[model samples]
Target: MSEVPEAEVVFVVADLAGYTALTEAHGSKQAASVVTRYVELAQEALEPGTRLVERAGDELLIVADDAARALRVAARLRDAVEREPLFPTVRVGIHAGRALEQDGRYFGTPLNVAARVAAHARGGQILCTEEVRRLAGEPDDVEYRPVGPVRFKNVTDPIVIVEVVAGRRAGEPTAVDPVCRMLVRPETAPARLPFAGRTYHFCSFECARAFAERPEAYAEA
Candidate 1:
């Protein structure tokens, strides 16, 4: 057995919401594809100081020395998942405190609390403890709304939880593909087509071809 190393760090756990239902609806193979994509997207979204502790099915445990960066990474993960048409929304929970690391895994009150907080979050929501907010400070791009003290199983006392609000800023232009419903930027879209007297953008050529094949199938009613 290895000794547990203690350190003050920020922990984040992100899990796919309604994963079981998605799997039931789409079968295991499709669900696995979504999970694989989510893991890849998360790895790309994390900041330099963050390390992926481990992955448990549809959930990922990540740690970082910078609390603010952890929060930003959570936001980015959520946004990335939202932009994927095949994946469900992700719920993220963050906490900053002293934790114990053993065998490349984290254990301690902070880690447990973060996992519990993640369970409380709804689809596409990011919840964090008050300590995380204090350490991270206020973010200009996102608003923090207090959800009040929440009680978790196996934890004494109520923990103050806050929701991180991140949305498209004003005047930010966005386009959604009708075939897959994924957000696409007009300038960088893989494929663009004119249909029904309007221009449509797609993330992939396959989606553009599908739309072109049956415009009536994807065209808005």
Candidate 2:
């Protein structure tokens, strides 16, 4: 029997947020279908230097050439499902590192980092390693914010995360929340406010009103 060819490929990992609760509520069979669809969508959309490597119920493994495209595709998938509201929110993690493959399958530290990064992602968000950011180039289509360094099991070094903006694709600013003091997703957020001659996104109408009611309460430097 011939062994599968050994080669290296870039790896990506992703997962649905709060899936455990869904699994408990939906049962194994129904949950299986939901996860299956997730992988199917990702598999159908992957571009060059990409392929579906594994789909174990709720987790997805994909190989890609650049991390930016990985992040872009995942964001698009989440945005697509979010528009329906019936679908659950999703999170994505991308890493651009070489992986060792056996029989056309890939594995190694790069794959593990991708999984850990995915675990840290928030709803409709994508997390990327520094290496990935460098390889993927600057992503102007999306805005990014630092999530600080996180510790993951089996990882000796702390991994820094960046949030891939999924709220509005617009290059224009939306609204900023004085309370939260960060740009919120316009669609999910209810209010838009002006600060420093630019609009900022808020998560809800209540936040918008709150900021308007007391501008000094949450003043920034």
Give the top-scoring candidate (TM-score).
1
Q: Model 2 scores what on Cα lDDT?
A: 0.65
Give each prediction's root-mean-square deviation over alpha carbons.
7.1, 8.5
Give the TM-score of each candidate: 0.75, 0.67
Mark the regions of model 1 whose C-alpha exceeds 4 Å error after superposition. 1-4, 167-221
Q: Supply the TM-score for candidate 1.
A: 0.75
Write one digit per residue (lDDT tens) for candidate 1, span 1-221.
Answer: 66666899899999987677566544689778988898999998888999887999999999999988898899888887777754466899999889877768787899999999999998778999999999889877878999999998889999999998865533232676666554466888889998778889876787788888988977776
Each model's lDDT: 0.83, 0.65
Error of 1 at 214 (Å): 30
Cα error, residue 210 of model 1, in Å, equals: 24
